[model samples]
Target: MKRERDHQFECGICGAEDRYLLHNVRHRTPSYRRLCTNCLLKDHRGLFCPFCFSVYEEPLPIDRSMCNKCPSISHKPCIPSNYPHHTPFICPSCSSPNFSFFNPTTNGDSPSGRIIDRDSARALVAAAKIAAVSMTKAAAMAKVEAEKRVKEATYAKKRAREALERLAYLAAKEKEIMEGKGGGSNYNGLYLAPPPPPPPQITGKVEK
Candidate 1:
């Protein structure tokens, strides 16, 4: 009897060691099938077993209509028999069904059941895309508004500084005038006063 030798490899997704192992060897031809650490993070399509969740990557197509469902190209199936019952039940990339489904929700509340028609599914996908776009636009608008406010504040501060400078200059000029240091009034005859003479005292003495 030949003792089976085990060859283990790291998971491509989470980098878990020894999560994946070589399997299904025939006549010395090595057919690798295993899961790793990294696969756990993916939704359903790219998930992996608990032991291999750390190393598994997204599965790839090995042949026509046949894919390994793991990160690497191997001759055997990566998903174990107890798949879909694992965590992270859906693929983040394509949103395909994974092997982790337990008591899967297949129908609607109606007794007859609600079939997912192609139009409805397409509409749902479209709606999700539109919502995402709207969210992006909203974020951009918020950023623009913040920039506008900042600019307004900067302009206001500048205006205030200029006004203060002008006020200081006017005050300095007024102080100089009060101290009689201003050369002379620029208004020469704009405000001139005349002298008045008095003759009432002489008239009162003559009458007495």
Candidate 2:
């Protein structure tokens, strides 16, 4: 079924005409009836309250808007003037006040205008604690795995070092043999002397 078109009031200030552009248009109250979008967002207090066109000349004592859902307090008004007030006072997802301090579901990406409450607040905190502990455990396990890998590498290095030392000792023995030192017998295969040249061939005719 087609939805009915809502009656929209013009911003008495800028005269911008359009339901979507109008600030707080969804919540049609007396004071906001003819106000422009700019003026409405600038309202620091209940200036644009539906009951009263509360444009208090002086800043109202209550500077912040309390979340109807979680009731968490935020520096930025739950209802920003530039954005649409889709879920005004209460959080749509958590159903808590938008002013909640600890919100698991209420990350930076959470949609605007949702409410949160005290019960939900506690739940959010508990969930966060569990997540933190889980992350810590995973990190510890990774460190242990890394240490094991390091130990294996060290063992391999030690074996290589021993093999190199044996090679050096064998080379020293071969050197001693070449220099006519007695150690030649110890390195049988490694220290073979060149064959003596054949006796000068008796090719020349034997002298009579």
TM-scores, all candidates, are: 0.33, 0.36
Best by lDDT: 2
112-196, model 2: which lDDT tens digit per residue? 4334555444433333333344346556666887899899999999999999999999888677667774333445466555566
Residue 138, candidate 1: C-alpha displacement in angstroms? 2.0
lDDT of each: 0.39, 0.45
Candidate 1, residues 1-208, lDDT tens digits: the string is 1222222454333334442221111111122223321132222223222222222334633431112344322223444456443243322222344422111135877564544455334333333333344356566666897999999999999999999999999878766764564243445323223345766664435543
Clash total of candidate 2: 32
TM-score of 1: 0.33
Could you tell me the lDDT of residue 92 within candidate 2? 28
* Candidates in order: C-alpha RMSD to true structure: 22.0, 20.8
